[model samples]
Target: MYTLKKSLGQHFLTDESICRRIVASLEAYPSRQLLEVGPGGGALTKYLLELRDIDFKAVEVDDDKVQYLKKTYPAIESRLIHQSFLDMAPPFEGPFTVVGNFPYNISTEIVFRIIEWRAQVQSTVGMFQKEVAQRLAATHGNKVYGVTSVLTQTYFDVEYLFDVPQGAFNPPPKVMSGVLRMTPRAAPLDVASERKLFVLVKTAFNQRRKTLRNAVKSLFSEEELQDDLFNRRAEQLSVAEFATLTFRMR
Candidate 1:
């Protein structure tokens, strides 16, 4: 049996039903140029390969798992990459789907990386800690809303699909798991202004307790943010409101 690796934040998915659900989220795609991040023990990988016309590439950080995957699925030996997902260059052209049962610790970073490569990725379906899932799908007015929510929402239409009980994994995580589906926006609210908006969102959430007037004070003149909308905390503003603030700053 494959053992969970603490250093790698490994928790292999043993539940086949959950695996199918994760894969089903990617059903909208025409080509199956699927990129599976951290395919621990190949549970999801196996299912993905069974699809007609499907081709898969997996990025795995664990050396042992990489070797095992290569040995177990010789057909995909050339496609399994042993490098860290953060370091590996994205293969394939534009608009591929990425799916996985991600490592809990690095899940956020993985999503961020995928966002960076949004030009190549059409959509994403993955499992995350329930708390993180909530944050990804959070709206501007939700208490759980913050930098991640704002940044991700700026680029993708996110959905909190379903919850997986702790018992689903081989070594069940203490927290519940949630599946999230993310599709890139047709056009960003302000595509060229993303950097400024990112900075503004980060600053606002960094001091979430403070009103936007105070949190974003450094980025704008007092006169610019004197509007009534700036009087509320970061959590109180919607994604469009945040975009408005970003445009004003620019």
Candidate 2:
């Protein structure tokens, strides 16, 4: 048995039913190559191994958990990659699906990583802190909508699958967990420069309480800032609107 490390955000999912449902969600978006990030206690790993049609692999940063998982799920022994997901390349040369009960502390970074690999990751299903899940699934005008929502929705069709209770884990997290299913859009939203869009989105949200005119003044000319659209706050702009703004920025 491996001890949970607080630094790693390891709350091992212990509920059998929740485990089945997560794997079922992954099956809904079938893929030949799949990667499970942070297979903490192997709750979901148990079922993922049974998917004979897929080439499944698990990535674990913790050496103890990696050893534990390999011992517990001998079937995944050869396929397990001992690594922090933030550090690895796409598991396959071609397209793949990703799934996991992701570490909460680094969950935001994980989303960014997935976006960086958007061309290769066709779909993803995973558990995240409920608040983060909502942000990822939210559209403009939703209170929780912010940078993550804009960036993720720019590239994927985000679905808020379902919520999981704290009691579902061995050492429950303080907050409720929500599962999300993200599938790549047929065509990602257009942007003049991906870099500019990212910078603009982050800048706007950093001053979210201010109107875009006031918040993003530094990015635009006085005339551009004078546009009627700048009267709205960052949260008021849809992802497409943000993309349009990106092109207008200096």
Give residue 144's lDDT in candidate 2 (0 to 100): 93
Over 1-250, each residue of candidate 1 has an lDDT whose tens digit, in order, gives: 4556988888788888988888877886555588889998998998887777867788898878888887887866888888899888887776688899989999999989988898788889999999999999998778899899988888899999999998988788899999999998766666438788889988999999998888888888878877888899999988877887776783
Q: Runs in model 1 with CA error above 4 Å? A: none
Q: How far is 23's C-alpha from truth in model 1 (Å)?
A: 1.4
RMSD to the hidden true structure, all candidates? 1.5, 1.0
TM-score of 1: 0.94
Clashing pairs in 2: none
Clashes of each: 0, 0
**Which TM-score value belongs to model 2?**
0.97
> What lDDT score belongs to each candidate, Candidate 1 first?
0.85, 0.92
List ranges where model 2 is wrong by over 4 Å. Answer: none
Query: How do all models score by TM-score?
Result: 0.94, 0.97
Against the true structure, candidate 2 has what lDDT? 0.92
